[model samples]
Target: MSQAPGLGIPGILHTLREYLVFYSGLGLLAGVSLLWSVLALPLRLVLPRRWRKQTGRWVITMGFRMYLRALSIMGACHFDLKALDTLRGESPMIIAPNHPSLLDALMVISRSPNLACIMKSELVDNVFFGAGARLAGYIRNDSLRSMICLAVEDLRRGSHLLLFPEGTRSNRLPIGTVRGSIALIAKEARVPIQTVFIETESAFLTKGWPFFRKPSMPIHYRIRLGQRFDPPTDVRGFTVELERYFQSALAEARLPPLSSMGARAP
Candidate 1:
């Protein structure tokens, strides 16, 4: 009798509602993402090229904030952005973060506000993000040479760049091998290099993880600001050093959940 629902049908209904909230929030996120691209079309036409990108980024930032808030409200997940305040107003720097989950970009972009990233080429034509991303002028990672040149140009123009040194989501625990492109970009742009360590308890949205199966409710995410380095003339050496730095950080970054850690909100 103790294992049965407290109030029979009402208790069962309550349990079902709790289980469905995450799916509902997921649906809302998808709908809003699609709507944003459609609504941004007019803005693209009216604003100048640079202004379009700036305005588009702000719009997307606001949308992402709202999206995160909505999920929080629905008891889906929460974000703990540590040391993110140190990056405020800092520009023309290369932001290198470990790719632990897909939510990493959204979390970082929301906090950085004006930062741009080298996005996948497929996203350039994605129905939900195609037009908006193009208007934002995000670099596509199709051609390495062209992408690096464009990234350096973006930095010179006072725009901060968010680069994932691991290139893609890590398949195993201590992070995967980093690409040399980040070093080349830092070398050519002559900008400061900052590493961000993303720590997560859940494995959802990782390399082969499916979206339908939700991780235990209220999935947690925390990011800590790692070391900052001055640009080095030696690109290859810098890449190797940075890779080792990340390997160590991820290995030792075994932190408790945000609630227990008493982390502050972003």
Candidate 2:
């Protein structure tokens, strides 16, 4: 439950050591990613455009899984992702999750191969991620109208779309303010929205949280599926209610259930 720890000199050494491994692993993965992206370029020229997109997405999905697993093997983090894997139904619904850390997208996308997300316009031009993202047909968050249209079309085509309604990582506990775009996407697409809860014991990689100042080793992360809802006709009201649900979820997650609180006979 402690977001940050104060562990004097030992803490500083651990932080530095963990960050060294983190950056080294990140660099290695980035190189592999770049290579994969460049190699996929030929598929664009040879295969049908649609087939190329699918293949590119598959590559991205595999890469993500490998990257996360490598981090786990390196003793950087461990994940509780069983609940998230169960949410991967065949239906094309919106995946709305709270953004606690930068790795949230990687965690979600690794499990859903058919998922495309709304990413920052800058990433589309990023040297390492841009090529892969473009080849995978990920949407950019530049123009709202275009983004909505693309998202709806993707859903109609049976592709799952992931959205972080908060728009950015949480700056405080109990999640941050949710945006209306998620509701708008659901209403326009007429698809259900599935909420996913990402619980982390540490605030590493959160907004303004220094990446090098790592938390305790093998940082714990858990993904539990929240309630799924059909898009209501009232977009504004639905958005407000959605935000409230996430707030309650965070609060409830912090408390023990009544059944668990009772004494047990030995």
Candidate 3:
């Protein structure tokens, strides 16, 4: 393949466009997150827990939806998330999506209101996300007992729980070891488990992609609803089954060319 400079006008213009979108997208995300955090700080202090959960999560969903729209409008990427809309207003359940990228949770959370997410311990205190997440009543993974209780309580209160089964991004192909938390939560809450597959054609934010590097555009992302498993009686067995299901389902899924992907995962 010819380098951008060698290809002249068209290639140069494409390169320039990619760079522009790349920086703009990252900037928009950081700016919005910071602004939301600042706005949420006061609300968290004033609003009751119930009001905060309702208003905060709804606000987050709309914000993420708009950010995604901006990315689409900017020609940075493409999204096929219509399938998730089908689950709206359905009974409370655990949404389990494959952890391919950091963006996976945002994709799910953006489509629904009042979805309680399990945030990374560090992110719960991150300047960009801490206040917003706390306002939304999102659970943190630092304490297992506390996390499970909070997650179960969220489910019992008619909120969808957004917890990645892989616990983190997949460093291996298909998936990482499926954690038993999903099963434990489902069984304890007596709710169903709705699986989702996030397929992408570029490794822009995968397990080991550089923050400053940009992927070739236009990247395509599609989220498809997978098997809906009822609450299992056996947690260990269910975890084994869930892992197998992901491995089998994603064995032929269209992931990016990860071998040549750049730098470390966030």
Encode model 3's per-residue lDDT on 83-198: one tens digit a residue. Answer: 99998999999999998777888889899996999988999999999999999999999999999999999999999999899898887777878999899999999999999999
Task: Summarize candidate 1's per-residue lDDT along 116-217 as a digit string, tens digits.
Answer: 789999987798988888788889999999999999998999989999997887755566778899989988999989999888776667766666756665
Which is the better candidate, 1 or 2, if ranked by TM-score? 1
Reference-based TM-score of each model: 0.88, 0.87, 0.94
Model 3: what TM-score? 0.94
Model 2 lDDT on a 0 to 1 scale: 0.80
Model 2, C-alpha of 165: deviation from truth (Å): 0.7
Which of 1 and 2 is the better model by lDDT? 2
Worst ten in a row by lDDT for model 2: 255-264
- After superposition on all C-alphas, the RMSD of every candidate to the true structure, in Å, is 6.4, 7.6, 2.8
Question: Candidate 3 overall Cα lDDT vs. reference?
Answer: 0.89
Candidate 1: where is the Cα deviation over 4 Å? 1-15, 255-266
lDDT of 2 by residue, 126-198 (tens): 8778878878889999999999999999999999999999887765556677888899999988899999988
Which of candidates 1 and 3 reaches a greater lDDT? 3
